[model samples]
Target: MSTPTRKPLDRHALWSLLSEKSDFWTEVNVVGVTGSTNADLAEAARHGAEEGRVLIAEEQSSGRGRLDRRWTSPARAGLTMSFLLRPTAPRETWGTLSLLTAVALEETLKAVCGLSAKLKWPNDVLLDGRKVCGILAQAEGGAVVMGAGLNVSLTEDELPVPEATSLLLAGATALDREVIAAEFLAHVGAVYQSWNERGPASVIERWQRNSATLGRHVAVSFPNGRSLSGRAVGIDADGRLQVAPDGAGAVETVAAGDVVHLRPRD
Candidate 1:
């Protein structure tokens, strides 16, 4: 862990911040460490916990990403949290939350930190084509728990992977986790309300604007040990990646998979 000590988020201050933004968030709580914020919040939601409960963990020990991929972050080095949401919209559209959060992070980072962060299809936030954040959404008892891990101030040697980066590595001027989280949740509140009222069309448009996947050749590995590669053409209605294979062929919508962007064909 870095030598810099980070104070755990003050529940009073965090709740105050959330309240000023909107009533959508019911509570904001913090934990020093946890296996996964998503898991903890999901359990709470299952027992009839109200929506808009936000849980932040200063450190995650057994963090797992999509497809059970391991995700780890040093103490106080990243934003690791889960927000509970109960949406009246069709469950089918829930997948868009990941994409929506990615856009929210981009908006917050660019506005507050002036970092040129971008989004890869699905739910990865990248700075200079390297991932700086990942999002995962899980359902429990008619509610959703959306967790996001945002890297803030990791040294080059502390990075979990070569393909990953942190704000510090990306030349971010500000490393204040609370500021970033507040700004990001504001956008999340707005987007969630908009999506529930209008639909996902506008959110999709905003996500596309920050997309680094569109127009790139990608290989998507499926759970069935299958992989598909093609040029990412668009995002489907269900928020899946639309890929047009090499040469003229039908476009395939990938529902879930590990996506690797391949270099442009020579």
Candidate 2:
């Protein structure tokens, strides 16, 4: 398939969209260059950037993801931003925040682009069974900085991998990156507020509904040279994965790992 031509986004137009929805996003900071928005927000948190402050970058030289994987961000083809928050939850509940962000992304994509994006355990968003978005979270002191990258208009030739796709490539031709970003922040802010008011249980329930990993045979690779294979049941309140291993007597709760959803060998 040939790549579709896209219009260059103007910073002023982006600002106008954000400003129109100022109630949700108060402090919008845009930069032309940064190592990574997540890193920038972490530094700002160390020095105390206000809560609800958002940092966006047009290009990231060193974007990061889980397991120290490099998030390949090529110029303006993707949305790269980090949002700061100081939730009142205890330190142990911090891990659930990433899943909450994924839920928010899934909802926003469906509502905005009519694309039913699903969460692939942890924080990846997949469209048509291919990765289109990724989320990363960091905790500093008592605050959390959540970073998200979405491929808005990248073509198949520009995609980082064959298993990766963009909104434009997946039949969302009318979608705009700035519009998507603005709407996403609004939805995310609401989800964050819900988590603050209700609890992790509410967030987990919403996450499960949008999860693609649930009910799938999967393998989780741990850093300590241990691994587990099972069918993903669901996510618990503490954000641990509940997996039912094949021929197992009991379900296993996985706290952390890189989960790969597998198909039964034919």
Candidate 3:
């Protein structure tokens, strides 16, 4: 296999592109490597870091997804980044941050890469039924840090799982990390501003429209060794996954879980 040319992100260039229109993204930090951008941002938020602070890493040594599941990608082969947010909305609506990021990612992929992506409830972004990105949001003090790991130039062998894919693998026209980063941040700022101004309904509507999970049969495994097999009915006001039980039961809302999309006959 031949080695692909992985371009390093130019923070200056990125800031210039973003600063022209985005009043939300105040700072951009690009590092060669880090244990986890999310960890870095979480610590910063606690220390009173301002909102709209973005931290991008070329590679993560200790990155994680929901439930602390390890998330890894080759150096400069993916978009591994996080941004801080402090919303004035009700605290209950804070849980929607990750979902909001997923929606923004879907828009970024479509507008920047020309690839139509779908949201797998909660935090995953899918392209052609394969996961292209994963998002995690952590709350610190009154701020929330949203992190995303997006596969960009990874080959099949570089994938962490068979179900995972990259922009290059997905046939994206644009492989420039700087371009994707700028476009993604812009989308995030715009979507977040809209959500804050118009309320959760704005983001929720977009999520449902681009969702790959809603109306699908799924099995959600919780940490307590219990699972719920149901059809994903909708997302509640708090961003919980509303699942209608298989046989007969109330539509249960799941705040956190491992969701597996089940086959039609399963």
Candidate 4:
């Protein structure tokens, strides 16, 4: 057997297909390499970049995840991109941006790649309990920039961590970045438009249906140095995770944290 060749995304094709799929996206920008798509989009948002502008990079030198942790992948090994949004929905609903994005990713992987993806609360998409995608949302002025990195063609030896997996590793034969990216954004536009028009209840419902974290024992470490171990009960209206702590503590609502699913004791 030989290594499969990874193809570069077709900028024109993605722009055309995404436009036909949804009128929500304004433009698509594909770069060979970038420091960070999220950083690029956030700066654009500050300078009045209109909503629906997308920035995608074939490789990221300074990619980042939540808590500013470094994220990196070989050139063309994955789909790394950022999308800009300035929704007219109530400001309170904005927190659902990452959740909605994760939901869209789950839908896209299933629809386009025939893979059943599950959402891990906050901003992760898991396959076989391994992370295949990570999402990060940054607020810039009145706009929001959401970035997602989906491992596509990385092999076992190329994985960043033992806990990470990719589409190829998950048995996906079709690894077209353009199709995956387009399908994902199309889903994003649909969910986002629905959230703005029909409110976030529907989006939240979809997220809950695809979630793997809810109802599971989890340990969350907050930025403030506090931690909670509990069963994830629900997602609050503000997009925080509501957890029923072990023992006898009030259900804790997590705004931001690193979550690790804990196995139940035998």
> Could you tell me the TM-score of candidate 2?
0.93
lDDT of 1: 0.87
Model 3 CA deviation exceeding 4 Å by range? none
Give the TM-score of each candidate: 0.95, 0.93, 0.97, 0.97
What does candidate 3's lDDT look like per residue over 95-181, in tens digits?
888889998889889888999999998899998999999999898989999999999999999999999999998899898898888
Between prediction 1 and prediction 4, the one with superior TM-score is: 4
Q: Which residue segments of model 1 deviate by more than 4 Å? A: 1-5
lDDT of 2 by residue, 180-248 (tens): 888788878888887887778888888888889999999999989898888998788789889987784
Give the per-residue lDDT digits (tens) of candidate 1, residues 1-266: 34456666676776676677776777888899999999999899989998888999999888999888899998888899999999888889888989988988998999888898888978899999999999998988699899999988888798889999988888888877877888889889989999978878888999999889999988988989997888899997779889998777899988888988888763
Candidates ranked, most accurate by lDDT first: 3, 4, 1, 2
All models: lDDT? 0.87, 0.84, 0.92, 0.91
> Which ranking of candidates, highest TM-score first?
3, 4, 1, 2
Error of 4 at 205 (Å): 0.7
| lDDT accuracy of residue 36 in candidate 3 | 94
- How do the residues 214-253 of candidate 4 rate in per-residue lDDT, one tens digit apiece? 9999999999999889999999887889999999989988
